[model samples]
Target chain A: MEGCTIIEFILLVIAYFIGLILLGIYAHKRTKKTAQDYFLANRTFGPVILFFTLAATNFSAFTFLGFAGKAYDSGFGQYGIMAFGTAIMAVMFYVIGRKVWKLGKEKGYITPPELIGDRFNSTSLRLLFMGVMVVFTIPYLATQAIGAGMLIESVTGASIGWQIGAIFTMFVIMIYVIFGGMRGSGWTDVIQGVLMISALTLAVVFIAINLGGFEAANTMAYNASPELFTRPGGGDFFMPMMWFSFMLLWIFADPMFPQIFSRFYTAKDEKSLKQSMILYPIVVSFLFLCPVLIGIWAHGVGLDVSGQKDMVLPMMVANYAPGFVYAFVMVGALAALMSTADSQLLSLSTMLSHDLPFKKRKISEINIGRMLIVILSLFAILFVITSYNPREGIMGTLVKTTFSGLAVLCPTTIAALYWKRATKYGCIASILIGETSVFIFQYNILPTFGLLSAIWAIIIAIIVLIVVSYLTKAK
Target chain B: GLWWRQSEPLMFGLPFWVVYLLILTLITSVAFYLFSKYYW
Candidate 1:
């Protein structure tokens, strides 16, 4: 990129951060000085804000950049997997989200593990859940930093290296969370969500027009590689068993994600949650599928994205888009990264400061929550600096592993709400065995049965929960 | 079964998966609307 173009992109990014900080300060001024208000936005999110925040928090730049690259390399089957998987997740929101939201409001819960521990009446189980969450969440958090760095560098053509970009990204999110907490995060998410959806829609439409519309572009892609448009898809991306495992992972494990689960507590009413669910599949599909289409278009036009798959979308925008459009899309991509990072940082801090068995005699819970946000951001920045050079499909690998690990908690979460017979021992045993089995299956230490590790872990978890709960009833 | 493997007869210049997913999005949202109204 030329120096002028690089300057334009940098200025655009700075402008976006300025907008976010102002929103953060506004939220901070409006929020009450209480733990519930700081962490849960006093449970006052309406349907529209609830919908955008949840959708934006669920996806990261990883959805657009990483999914596009994966689809470009693996074929449209990956897109199908993501689109359908997300829709299934929305369905779960109707059943699980309502139950969780009602309990959260009645009991004044701050986090999911807090509800789980209180329901089972076990501090140890809560601590165990927090530990599992922190471990899995780190990589997912690091991906945001990595993605921000890659996006900035690609758009500016290495005028800004990914490391500095990552650092700046970390700083922006931390500042917002420190200032606004959940309210700030929610406000910023609404803006980012709208910007991202618009950018993706516009990017696809522009790319299609450039490549002679969707019909011609689809024809070109089909002629080049027909398998990409088919069921099994090119590159043998969709194996039957693995696809089944992925579907199961999305349906069961996604709601258990800390950031997503927090939205259940943040929603104001049942109708709001329901309205968010009703609108989610429609918005989410377009937000995700547009990038996949752009990726296919790039491939059809014969852009080589090998060895650096995750940067394909950025590369396409840099090459084909006008300077103004390039800067706007870059802002959108960074918005996606920051939206998720802010929520994850807050969720991690909440777990460490509140959900875990930590005494707050010396310091207030909200202050400790603020301190942990800085700590986690610094920790993630260090992880990003060390593990900067990830290989192809790194995004896909990190995301899948995180989901599988979180899936270990799926049975426990559901049972805590539904099964009165569930015991503390069963919950703890389920978590330990489920988490360990997920790692084992992840590394192929155990037989996978050609399924995802999460599937196996969940199977083991339910058995352990049942047998152990039966063997040792709750006193 | 080749039920999912049918990619030749394209719909609206898109292939099977693209059309199927687009249609699936509409179906899912409508289903969610009804489920939320009555069942949920």
Candidate 2:
């Protein structure tokens, strides 16, 4: 609504894009015309860079928009679930990342599907994983696009609709990622990570100063809605079993996400992976905290956040924040979204170009990877422009659906890595059972069996994997 | 029920749950550091 604020924000966004193009050119010079250079960045990332890229990729718009909005709508319990789940998931990385790194190095694996397919000696199963990666990743990618669009619309008003903003985001991401490859994405992630944190820190400081101090802000929020400071009432908030399921959701499925699992392949050494895992939860918890504080601030200011939950942060900043502060924060949100969307598209491109059955013998791997990135980026842009819905909060119903779908693949990965008895037939059975059960439970076609759909899916998958492995063992 | 799960006993002028989350995060970082040092 304010002229100066909108002008300053637009200028910052333009500056950010210019920065990304420069980074893309730098990455392009180093990028060789090979799969390893394009997809895994030649396995060159150390612990610190790995940590930043992973943290940036992991948080996404979901952290700032969806999760923060959830906190505003629900309560502080959203933070507890995410912070604790992430800690536990970090431990999973410790257990899994080292093994994956070693295997990737030894066998020259780039995607999770490639690793699993070779391990099980089954191409069909690998394709299944690739299918899951492409199908489920679209919404997550679209979420980022939708988030960027919403941020633009919130700041710029109806002059530029959110759909056009989303299209512009997709176009920008396609350029850097198609030219720069993984190195471009990884280096850009470092910048994006810093922007993401700075945005949150500035917003937090701005809100705190406006409300007198952090304590006063908390008091004001409590006065405005004491139940928002508590648990389990306002809107199906934090039921015990449901909370347990939400916690399990990320711990089990996040490591299987193509974008994250591929990072395990890029670690320079075992120690780098180990150290990153050790530091990950700490960094992410801090990142996660910033948005929750903003959410609480929104509530304290008495915004109608529940009705327009995703708009909480942007609306607050646009209405009340200092112009430059809002500019930096919006760019941070844009950087966060692009960082995530690029990573996911890169992973999807790797799967399509390298893992799929269709083989083109003549084309260079880098070209194919770049081509796939363009196609997938266009697909995502189309999805966002035609069907993008902001009503689906960042961490809300849609992400849960995606996570639940992805969780089915986790048992197959764990069993393939750890259990000698895990067979091709077993993995196939388990993946089908796990994925199908999520749909069944999610749509309430079957009883939930006293737990969430994801939990039920995991239970069913583990059982089916073991049973089929034993029964179908080689004679 | 866990004591920190309650809303009472606001620590440092914040809710018990919020303080509990910070403690949980600290414990997690420390535990992870130890794990990396010894086991990993």
Candidate 3:
């Protein structure tokens, strides 16, 4: 916002990049031998690092940036819906995570789709899900990269080219993820997790001090716009949208997110998996509250900068915070964005290379994974450039809607894991319906409903799976 | 009509704030031992 602030931000950006480059080099040398070392961190990470890894997979830039914007503009209801989807998923981790962990250990599984395909006897199902995941996630990835660049701008100044910043940071993420693998990602997540909290805590503290405290923040916000705190559906419709989006897209629909699944086979026992599950949702709940609170603070302060929404947190830090504190905020935002991006690039790459049918032995998987990393990187960069204006982009909208559509897979996936009777046809039917729903919704051909898309999709999927499984006798 | 702070606490006591720090310390110590014995 000022000349001196811009100078401080640029210096902070330099220091943060230097730190990450060194960390990448350090990880590359530390773990190099087996793919297990690369992908699963040798299955030896303690509950702590493992805790953050599971949590990191959830705290994307969207949480830090987009949701903060949402919180700033709307109110707390959206945050509550996020909690609901997360709580249900956490229970899955406690109940289903252990099962997946056990099965992974027994079978030497690498991805969620591997388990899904094996259990249900459906190869096409695995590939189809993986394809949707990669395509849908690229926009999600672009969101991360763009958010990171925006963070750079918020701290340093708008003079820094977003495309330039995004590409450079993305390349750094690829190097660490490609070379060091999950260990790199997991360790980085631990550091990034700390930075994310520190940045959030710093911002929250500064804002609260300025506004006096949470009570004062609430009072001031009410003074500005009573609707900010109390409105139907929590003053904004975004929360219900997220509940459907997160559950269907993340929980039930996309069964195999490679990062989380990669950890499943690596976790030592059922106890570790259960503990990690319980710990993760709670940690995420805490991390999410920081931004949401900051959003409330922003409303109270009455700062109405327009067009760029996600930049609220960083810009607020720049405005209210001292120069050195602003530096910390800059690095913290970097931690949040890259933590999510590194895993995304790695997982997307792995899905393409190892999961897709390459023309050779399964052991030949290593090389394909790296090559796919480069392609995914290129594809993501192109998509970001095309997006030009993220708010109007078809990609993000498609991803948001499609996630709800995937709700069709929820019942089928959960049933497949436990119910031995879950036939291949059941899984197939769910996938077909889910994919079709996403396409239909993306085109806006259907009317809006009260329930989330994922909920409706899952409801339909379960009914079909039950009826179809019943009609088709077991072999 | 409804109370809000109830959702944000731990064991309804002072421990909620310190829980993650404790877990982090415990997990790190155990991990260090496991890694040194097996992978390192």
Candidate 4:
């Protein structure tokens, strides 16, 4: 039976890859051989495709593994933070996303840096924006690879080790991304996004039934660890200040993520972007509840995932779920991570190829972008094998590092779009000060007053940007 | 905020705070829907 289950899992994984590759080939055929078509899918995504791609890209391994892990370690507040915070971010989707889409369509902007650089008319500012994006996004990207490796390792019982699993996942993602570009990534996101939501919903329902019911599961978990149901949760992680900090952080930071920022340029119309904004909160809020519930319920089932909280969901499925169900959920987890990684790779490639000051060469821009995808994927794989520390937990690392770092860019981006007097020097000073402050707060160089470092960094960045812009305004 | 620190008063198999947040999420969705239809 074990052998049979292993075979079934392997076959499912292979079939999933084949489907993705076929989709990539189809997208390649449809592709117009232009930089615009390759990077932004010719600016033709409708509401449904836009919504799925945006949600899938935004959620990532962080949603699948990290949410559950944090819920296990913290508590129910995890749901409030993500669901509510993301719902609020949808407002920005209209405020920032609409303007970005219009500007991108009008100005022929292909990357986030392009929009910023053109607005400021400064190559230095553009490169700095690109530099901050690439530096921060790589760690987040590495987390996806790490999540994929761990999922593979858990499902196969280490028959194929994490290193191989990580490399293999990156390799497959590279092929599809290079082949399909934006269209391929968008189309696959629709499929993977649906699969991830459905599989997780089913797995959670199945697990709840097995452990009695939703009520019983909650009761058992609460009885085992009552603190989990409250604010400040198990280790006092979500105190009032931190809760407020997170709520504010996601609003400013989420849309700043390079993959998500690049996605704004893909919307076919303002209506499509608006439709996505409406659906985002509803879908993401509900979907997030599934993993958080499962993570908390793992405690109900008496699974002790003390140090390795990220493994809670996988470990629970492995122990209680049928082999087929286990395989399906693992595939869903892979879908979650791969969807995000492919977009990240594509967005990074687009930014580098379009925004950088490359000498005129015979190679087409699309080809150069494709080569960067390969290089970036390999770099991510190397980071996963060499630097990723599993015990720190995905949510903790992201909130401390990626979320905070990218968030500092929000002030600069918003200023570029809305503030006409926003000089390049102002933008440059904001990013420099914002990132440096985040680093300081992260390493405990200064107290956060019980709030996340991001809040402080953003405040500092905003003040610096405003003050600097006023001082350097053109007469 | 301090009132939600206790684990009692489970509403529909979830803590009251969890239920409150879920309700808040539903409200947010409805609000966004209205925003999309009318305001946006």
The model with the greatest DockQ is: 4
Q: Give the candidate number with the greatest TM-score.
A: 4
**A169-197: candidate 2 lDDT, tens digit per residue:** 88889999888888999999999999898
Off by over 4 Å in 4: A1-4
Give a tens-digit lDDT track for model 1, residues A82-116: 88778868877866788899999999989888888
Quote the positional error of residue A304 for candidate 2 in Å.
3.0
Per-model lDDT: 0.83, 0.82, 0.64, 0.89
**What lDDT is reached at residue A37 by model 3?**
61
Q: Give the winner by lDDT.
A: 4
> Mind sharing the TM-score for model 3?
0.84
**Clashes in each model (backbone N, CA, C under 3 Å)?**
0, 0, 1, 0
Candidate closer to the true structure by DockQ (higher is better), 3 or 4: 4
Question: What DockQ would you assign to candidate 3?
Answer: 0.05
Q: What does candidate 4's lDDT look like per residue over A388-462, in tens digits? A: 785577887888888899999999999888988889999899999999999899888999899898999999999
Q: Which stretches of candidate 1 lie over 4 Å from their true place?
A: A1-4
Q: How well is each residue in A323-386 modelled by candidate 3, as lDDT tens digits?
A: 6776786778788788878888877776676567767565546567777777787777886677
Number of residue pairs clashing in candidate 1, backbone atoms closer than 3 angstroms, sequence gap of 3 or more or interchain:
0
Task: Give the clashing pairs for model 2.
Answer: none
The docking category that best describes candidate 3 is incorrect
Model 2 misplacement above 4 A: A1-3, B1-5
iRMSD (1 decimal) for each model: 1.6, 2.1, 10.4, 1.3
